[model samples]
Target: MGKYIVIQGQNIYDVALHIYGAVEGVTDLLVNNESVSFDTDLKAGDELIYSDDYQINKEVTAYYKMHGITPASGEQHVYPKVFSLPKTVEIYTSAKEVGVEFSVSGNGKIELDWGDNSEVQTITLSDKITVFSHLFDSTIGNKRHVSMYMQGHINQLDISGLRPIELYILKSIPIERFVLNNATLSIDSLPMLETAFGVSLDGLKTNDLTPLLELKNLMSLSLTQTIYRQPTIDAYLIGLVRQHDNRRNCKVVMTARPSGEYREPTRDSNSHYRITSGMEAVWVLTHEPAWNEGGIWEFIINETTYKYEQNH
Candidate 1:
């Protein structure tokens, strides 16, 4: 007989293999730890018992009797075990879509309160990862307050979903870290990034950079893997500096290393002059000269400053 403490990703078979050098001992281990079933999701710090006696523990025998689970006298039963609801759930909403993802440890249904005076929705889920998505109705207003409910026991009961922009306007929450890699952001959605101190739009497929100028509080911005041409990049930088000229003092930081295909600079020489004066400090990430590198650029205009880093 022996006791083992479960670690992350360690299952009953793993414990059996570690203790008895064979997975065939898993049934024996379960019989000793009758409180735990074969389908139980083990967590770290859980205690497990293993032995060669093959005697079913009193707790397990009681559980089987209470649940009316039975098998032939000589056979071992492996059925779905009752589980508690997940401790965490995530909800994401965009302009047109709403998505919810969560884990279910057992068979159950989830109830949702959209908080729009609409009928509550219930969804059945099995033991697995569950994802629910729906098209958002514009009539529901730009903001949505959502609540989730489940039948089983859990640590948290009040979960709400709010739009990124709503969090800023209603709660005065300034977004410090934002990532939109490979996402198509609409002009109307740009306001969500307005108060963000740091933002990444890598692999974005937008043709308009003008909307980004509205991010007056932006400290660091990454446009890596974006589809902006040299002219568009120049225009965006110029516009950003002009908008910030008298509002705040800012600095630009860049690294010397270029990634991606090299491209020619924009044709406007006046734009280059603005880059030199308005740009407090420019760092080039490419092997090319700081002034010629097409990857990253920094500029400061009067009281406004911003740093940009890009990869081909």
Candidate 2:
């Protein structure tokens, strides 16, 4: 059994829908708490008991899967395991200057270990985006391996700025969202990856997407300013979600904003990607025409508002 505390303006039906994905679970809620009936008023902080074996409607799960959004009741969040470190990231680069910028949805701590025998730098993060950078010696010709260890639940990691190096991360962290630009990082690097945004897929032949076809848990992938050699948009988007004989649902975002005079994607500044998977993917490419409205779009998911604005 599980307990749900009532909040302001909540009633038995709200609890039923929240737990079971449908209001029909009201019967089960009423039966479990005989002391409380439909006639009884639900007050703030009132504890209500519910069965653990309750089944969420299949449609709810399908809808979530189509968009790569995981609910609280999903199996991935339920599994438990032991790990030496709860979260870790490894970066393989030869760039003299190495740095990474990312943010967390809540409170957390992230530490970086530069392989060149530098002091381990620590970053304390809040809802505000945090950045950490370290300069490496360009004199060294060999590639250096940098590592990141994290504590607490941080939601998003953006690897922008200078990339084009190998990225290796542990499977324990379960980071569901990522932002990549000019990066040679393998898609298979993160084990629990469910949603990702390929920041810039500009070049066609240069983007070796062989590793992309081998994904497992990916639910959404939006490649901005994309230029692929695929026969058609339909085949390319569907190929992302299909794994040979096994097929799955994945929501993809496509927009057709004209390139700049230099043929680069129009970007007045550092634009934003969907920071969290729970944030709805508004104006998704579902059927027919391949592009969506190219401008600022607003989306509200899970009571949070996120805007995907482009300066076309």
Candidate 3:
């Protein structure tokens, strides 16, 4: 990333919108400069390193060292900027045939390896998602590990009807937005390591969302219209996140409901912190009425308090 010297008084969100033309860019800023939080004030002349298309200038690296600021390693991004670098998702399916596809902006390309030793499918990406469906070849084993690589800087990746038993996204660069639908995958099987910034899950398997607490890099999550046919929310995940070190802002969207009547698990439960469900958390119960007609509930969690704003 290149360097930026703030010439005006601003905050993290302002700077992110200014630099990347999108407020969501704040995730990269936080990842790069851990010393700076979402609430950090950016005054004029404050030097900061950010993700960019340009190479890191050696002098900028030296300046960071002299200033005792260590840029956190790993993908750290934006344009309102396209995401370059290749982002990959591997799907392991028991289905007789495997099908998956996505689209990317710019002149980016997509490659799909059937893993059946057949010819790889490559396409120049377009506005519409390029789809690939392949029948399992018995000689190569019907069960396959199909892989898709997205090249270039596309913000969102959406794949539906991929009933993968196991799915994982491994990337050289972070894909800020992702959507998974019609899959048997569970959050527990995901690596969850800094791969995504915002994820929307719908029509997926696993109502047990306890594994969501393990997420490390996320600004937004959507569970609405998901596996939970019951108007239930996983308050346990929220309680644990509140207990953990995530004071920074995270937006969670789910169906309208309290945590439901199940025994909630927590660190205090002495179960090694494995997530449990039960009890209507204060926040959920308070906002339960907003989504009575099937709307979106956005949960905002900050340092001390948590709340939700609903759109009907």
Candidate 4:
């Protein structure tokens, strides 16, 4: 059988890269083929053919053929031991220069390109900060950056291949899926990334999301409110516990509001914990305070007083 080389879905540079490892390696051979250049990219179905002589052949072949270069008939052709660096990036631009794109859901896609051998990256911008810069072209003496930012609503950031260098969230928004490969996230622009996908506060700093619990979409919340004035604090805690006990699934952690008396909820075998009176602190921690079949309920008046209450 005659030995033939075939490369499918690659441009001249890519074929050359497969043959000699770099575009520079086959510059002399491919310079005669003016249709292809070093930077000229190829699609998924391009092909290059070589005859049994290991020389370039001008013939179109099937779509699903062998990729890269192959050996010639009698010559012991050795493929490149190494290859050029593959570009590491996938980017998307915004249509509305300052508006939302993929607000909540959908199979929508933006733009993607791995210009050269660059590091992976991910970036996010809030409404206030609405500009993303990138260096897509390297040969232009100076790096180039494209502008991508919207005004209202959360933009679905789509940079898959590049490692994350920086991420910025301008305003508070329910993050659907903000992935950063390996970079520090900048959230200084007014409560950025309040919740992940508008459901829970996962992958976010606790303090940054406290104020957003009031959002209607946030379900099953665990709120911890501290109270001072020991005597009054117990009442407050009890009231909150009673309110939250029957809710679906919620919790609250509390510490003294004004640094009076600091008391944490304690469990007692006999169901009686100590409480204190006025000018002290008390804790009334409750967890979904619905009616239970049988359980011990301890009530602390302040930090000295204690009450043994049974759950009905």
Question: Model 2: per-residue lDDT, tens digit, 68-99?
Answer: 54222211211112233344777777535555
**TM-score of predicted structure 1:** 0.32
Quote the lDDT for 178 in model 1. Answer: 51
Best by TM-score: 3
Residues 49-79, candidate 4, lDDT per residue (tens digit)?
Answer: 4322332322211111243233221211222
Highest-lDDT candidate = 3
For model 2, the local distance difference test gives 0.48
Residue 143 CA displacement from its true place in model 4, Å: 10
Q: Residue-wise lDDT of candidate 1 within 82-114, one digit each (tens)? A: 224331222334433354322333345556554
**Worst 10 contiguous positions by lDDT, candidate 1:** 153-162
Error of 1 at 286 (Å): 16
Cα lDDT tens digits for candidate 3, 52-128: 85322344334444555432221222113233435477777763554444444334676666554245567675555
What would the TM-score be for candidate 4 when compared with the true structure?
0.25
TM-score of each: 0.32, 0.43, 0.47, 0.25
Badly placed stretches (over 4 Å) of model 4 are: 1-136, 139-165, 170-182, 189-312
Give Cα-based local distance difference scores for all models.
Answer: 0.44, 0.48, 0.53, 0.32
Number of colliding residue pairs in model 3: 4
